[model samples]
Target: MFLRKSFTAALALPALASPALAELPHDWQLGMQPAATPVMVQIEDFHRLLLYIIIGICLFVLALLIWVMVRYNHRANPVPSRTHHNTLLEVAWTLIPVIILVLIAIPSFRLLYFEAAIPKPDVTVEAIGKQWFWTYAFPKDGNFQFDSYMLQDAAAAKAHEPRLLGVDNPLYVPVNKVVEVDTTGADVIHSWSVPAFGVKMDAVPGRINHTWFKATRLGTYYGQCSQLCGANHAYMPIEVKVVTQAEYDAWLAKAKKKYAANETPDALRVAAQ
Candidate 1:
């Protein structure tokens, strides 16, 4: 009765805490996403820089449009300046865009290389994208493979977890470890996207695309398929559980024993049980 009351109180608190605000399950907000990982922080910085540039450009363009409409109107200036085109203005317009492209290209290429470049990874995992599910193999640990499916609505509701974003089996990794991931598909194409990790790559059939990330914090990060592959594409969600090194090692050991087949019957039953 106490546990039930506690759970109900917890659920009620979120609603009353901030009635006007849209309550996000995690600490990250809608306007501001999580920068829990190192790569994600870099991506966030890049995003802010790009946003400033875009806003500046938009305001400038709007001002220019208004000036043209008001100052160049027939009532304002009956006699137009006898000028087809100014060479300086033409050159300025052409070269300014080129300079802007160069400015944008430097960081864009750097980010691409950062995402594509794989460093000396502390751990490696092979992620296989199946129809409406994801299968993960911790090849470096013990070749222990498992499938991750979306938690049913009833299950999520019982657990008080996020709807449509929670999973039965979440991918676990140690914080501050460079995790190398190789992605492939069993059927059609699917893209694994985690905005908080700054990682997104297409899972192509018969081929593997590689990416890596080093999580800087311990938290439950959520993501989903960025590409629409099939009818149940929205059903597949990605949950990453980052833990301490000691906890990760313990989990790996238990996972290896849990998936092993050559153990004693009682032990096997206990592990499975």
Candidate 2:
């Protein structure tokens, strides 16, 4: 189909030098996107740890099921036990599940705390989630702000950008800098999330939620609104360009001029487009 060809052409395009335009997802990716931050790396480790535990538990249960069928099935044992009061077996089952829960909880709590504790941010960006778009403001960088709208499929095909993923503007941050994102919804609840950075924070009405990420590499990462907000929720994409400090400064200078700090949201949003 034409859509399939467009996708193939988009993926085949080579990457640019600027980190702002970096790696992208491919078809049928089975694992996480390459981790570009320490937080994401830790997330991957935690996931693998849980995966092993789950596999072990599943295998154990399968073995138990097989043992029960072989040892106590009607064919194997014609006489069913009249008295089925196995206190030891009941205790073992209860205790084993409790132990498993404890194992899962320890790391779960640790990861939750680590994600919640926003370290001193090198830069802070406020992401205002609207019905089907994102408005990003860099408070540390002269308060310049802009709206990021998804590129149309036609434009995306022409530019070789991923369909439904490319945006008119991208949130840019310096590489290896702790970038704190404050999220709030302009309309319905939305979630600002980037999987590679392992950052996902809800954008609730009248409430600012925070999350942080320090991009260890210079590249462009993509995400979409994790929350279902509107009819066009699928169109709300997030693109972040992680560049060097110098590149960030230069971009900021231009952005402050382009998207004036003094301008109203309506005016700035129009100008940015």
Q: Which candidate should be chosen as best, given TM-score against the real structure?
A: 2
Mark the regions of model 1 whose C-alpha exceeds 4 Å error after superposition: 1-32, 261-273
Model 2 alpha-carbon miss at residue 106, Å? 1.1
Which pairs clash in the backbone of model 1? none
* Local lDDT at 63 for model 2: 100
Worst 10 residues of 2 by lDDT: 13-22
Tens digits of per-residue lDDT, candidate 2, 61-118, equal 9999999989999999999889878999999999998998998899888888988898
Residue 25, model 1: lDDT of 45
Expressed as tens digits, the lDDT of each residue in 1-273 for candidate 1 is: 999999999998887544312222455445555676677787888888889999998999999999999999999999998989899999999999899889988988898788778999998877778899987776557756788899999997776557888788888889999999888777899988777788888988777788889988777777887778899999999888788999989988987877654222232123222
